[model samples]
Target: MPNPADRNAMLEARRTLKMAQSPHAYVRGNTAKFYEWLAASPVSRRVPTGPAIWICGDCHLGNLGPIANGQGSVEIQIRDLDQAVIGNPAHDLIRLGLSLATAARGSDLPGVVTMRMMEEMIDGYAAAIHDPTSGVPGVESDIVRSVERAALGRRWRHLAKERLDAVEPRIPLGKKFWELSAEEREALTTLFAEKHVGAMILSLQGKPKDREVRLVDAAYWMKGCSSLGLLRYAAIVALKTRKGRWSYALVDLKEATTPIAPAAPGADMPDDDAERVVAAARHLSPYLGSRMMPVRMLDRSLFIRELTPQDLKLEVDQFSHGEAVRAARHLAFVVGTAHARQMDPATRTEWLAILEADRRGTLDTPSWLWESIVSLSGSHEAGYLDHCRRYALAA
Candidate 1:
């Protein structure tokens, strides 16, 4: 059992309020509930266990987005690995499908549109698995293209304004960033002093190997939905260049907790939560993975990474029929590419064969994916309404 002291009642209340806002918000915040339902569902036994590769265990649509690599090249991929584990690839597919379907419902799009999106999703996923080297298609969607443009045009000042509330060099401790306890602050200072941590800070800009890195400011970060009660901190570090100039980098340190998503039997992964998240990121999202470091902070397993302005999450509150189809295909391709790269040729072939099978009659999509989405969507909708009712009564 988790330590009761670690649970913050205030944050938990805030999280509940956020989840009650909408069905989509509820879906994003309740990953554990989804997994619990999946375990008990009849479809759980029928879903094929593909190659046991690292999967984004909480793979909702919001978790997939454009992230900048160390070289500053931005690509769409899974951005969160909090619940990542070496598990069945089918879980990712079903989770993503459910997310898209829920978004369609939120947008007031017709049920048929959701069905078509699922088909496009399977088509796109299969394409990537077949040709791992090819890039994801359907960037023509306005949402993705606009985000790409915004990410490309952003710089340090943009990041500073959005995250730090100013172009200043220090982190402000207030609503979004609470004051860190003295011990937590001391731990952060000690963490940045380590050789490997300093190397990671300098590696962000490919700064000279010997550049002096110093922790400028840090604070308790009040962020995220499901991860609200966990230990999270934001640290600002100054990198001194040889030219006697200094540049700042924002580093995010988040506690890694026991994942609710079950790993495959006999899966080989580090026992430490932080290491497990880093390992999965390396396999599933090399762009974000290359920039992350697993470390120990405050006697807890935590992962740290430099935050780039280009790192953005996908936000889709509404969708058109055409947009839904295109987005589904594009996003599925992104996820499939991540899963495909980890498997050998023979494993890929076997997985693809499994996915291609069980297509009903003239339908291009697999039956299991469609059925799983339908069932999960209904389950989540019922859960969301019940949650809202309880929240109302509490109010």
Candidate 2:
């Protein structure tokens, strides 16, 4: 067990992380209530846990997306590990369910379809551990397909497209990620063809080609709220391990760890923060590939990954009732499995029961559970906004 000081510091880090990423009007409005709730809740301590391995700490809606495999086979994989940690299972479940609630604010599906979609996500997560290859029922391994499916989702299809006719996502990224500019096009070209990108030719995992391979720039884009002040880059590479087969690989590298935290007090020395984050991500996400370099710059850390087409995030509210229920259940199962992996059989079974009971409608979907998270998220958002306001006023 970690000492009290370390635990307190970690909590402070989380609050600070929130402030650094969200806006002020958002932060001030919701801060104190959240901290108070956390302090009062017995379950809160069970969360914010650590010393395990690889947790998607900030398991929010926007943080999840699509990514392709080495052969460009699209998978419903999770992305955005910037806030990942090796810690408490409760933290992930609470945050994930809370994000689902936030997404409920904008879903297009009635009730059923929304439940199904949510359930599918949870199912997807659980299944991933066993196969890591199962995608949607019939789609081939390709990024475009994942993007299309994610765009349509279950609720949108059931709503007959009526649900999404007017709704637009509140993606934090600028519009350019969905579009492209001339300079950005050129940059993508360069990244893919030179500088950074490559295919592994041999069946070996640790063996290197004994040479630096250049990649072409795949896209010009922007992403992540926490990485507002850091560098993010992506490149494309084609690999042909077999004699006649060829496939595209999209490699991406982004900066994580923000320059500030809302709930946490005191100024941060960015250099150290960047180092810790880069180290953690690299250490935890081994699939980030062996040769992938996590670079440290003056004020930021760069993380590398294969640009998979299957990456996607869904707005929970837009889904149908069924889809939402499904998604919730699906997410619940994944959270349960992750927790089970780190705990004793008894502890694992306990949470699994809680998750399954809720999913099967055996337990009343606790309105209070999601409400608390929203309260927490809202508070952090407020605190963050306050921090930003103070900065803007100073500037």
Candidate 3:
């Protein structure tokens, strides 16, 4: 962790600088602002009441990407669940729509292209609601395909090189990793000494379940936009198998907080925030959820998961007209599948009808969705400019 005296200030500076880089970056970093706008706007009342199910409360383009399951199978799914909750599914659709629209604006795409992307997004989502078991649509953009291929070919070496900047069995203390306090190190050592924690690491790599695990190295990890100020650590562990081979795993421990995204009224949820995040992940993104284990450290709730080389977020900074529309369809399809699987046949049918009923004669997409995107986009753009001005003055 950073020096306790300067941690918050340093992290706030870094977060602001990152969010000021582009409009899409701003959208990704400002989840609280997004929900606040929805709460204060009349548009919130118009959004259809979706079935109460687990949602990727902060669903945005940057949050969806390729993830590997415990068995090493790769699929596109929601990768972040810090803000997840049993909430209205329509909130996710609107959040994702805002992300796509802001990204289109960042890429300098015309307004008409953004409108078409929204139409395709609704079409793709409705398709999944109609048939949850159907395969992903074949209209993926070249950028997405390239990312999928890269994710499939990645291995431990790639992850070590990219994240740690080397394949050594230690976390280098530099820009991304910092020396941990003695107390922090001792807590991590005690946490990893538990039998269940050792078993979890061994199971991920198919090693002998009874083998002992050693914490080779640990550091305060600097990662994520919204999670910059939280308790984040990267710990590398080693286990020797009966065959005299050694296995290694990179574990990510992140603090969990109360979600800014509102949960459905009277929703029954776990009181522990970490437990809520873990449950949400399992329901919305099994590949990610399967690897997660909630734990407590220094009296704070945190969740630890083994990081796979194949897990990567989508980076859609620039988009052509064709790529724009295709990406909207494919990404929305992934989100729809997450939401649709939790609903029964009748519930899904009812949700689809609700979505379809919102479309006007000429507009293929729902007017409410389109209007929400436009309103949120305008608000965020102005917010971004104001944020940049303040950041500049601070610097």
Assess each prediction's global lDDT (C-alpha) against the native. Answer: 0.86, 0.43, 0.89
For model 2, what is the error of residue 108's alpha carbon versus the real structure, in angstroms, after optimal superposition?
8.8
Candidate 2, 155-243: lDDT as tens digits: 31232223112223111223323333455455545544443333342212222443334442343334333433344544444444334
The TM-score measured for candidate 1 stands at: 0.96
Clashes of each: 0, 82, 0
Expressed as tens digits, the lDDT of each residue in 1-395 for candidate 1 is 12335447667777889989888888888888789878899976778889899999999988988899988999888999999999999999988998889889889999999998988888888888998787846445677767877898889999999999989988886767777778887899898989889998788788976888889999877786655657888999999987999989999999999999989999998999999999999999999999999998777899999999998999997898899888988888989999999988899999988998877654466877887888888888899999999989998
Residue-level lDDT tens digits of model 3 in 87-107: 999999999999999999889
Ranking by lDDT: 3, 1, 2
Which 10-residue span in candidate 1 carries the lowest summed lDDT?
A: 1-10
Candidate 2 — worst ten consecutive residues by lDDT sum?
Answer: 163-172
Query: Candidate 1: which stretches are off by over 4 Å?
Result: 1-7, 138-140, 361-363
Any idea what lDDT model 2 has?
Answer: 0.43
Provide C-alpha RMSD values for all models, in order.
2.3, 11.8, 1.2
What is the TM-score of each predicted model, taking all chains together? 0.96, 0.53, 0.98
lDDT of 1: 0.86
Query: Which of candidates 1 and 2 reaches a greater TM-score?
Result: 1
Model 2 misplacement above 4 A: 1-53, 71-75, 108-212, 215-221, 236-249, 258-293, 297-300, 315-317, 339-347, 350-361, 365-371, 377-395
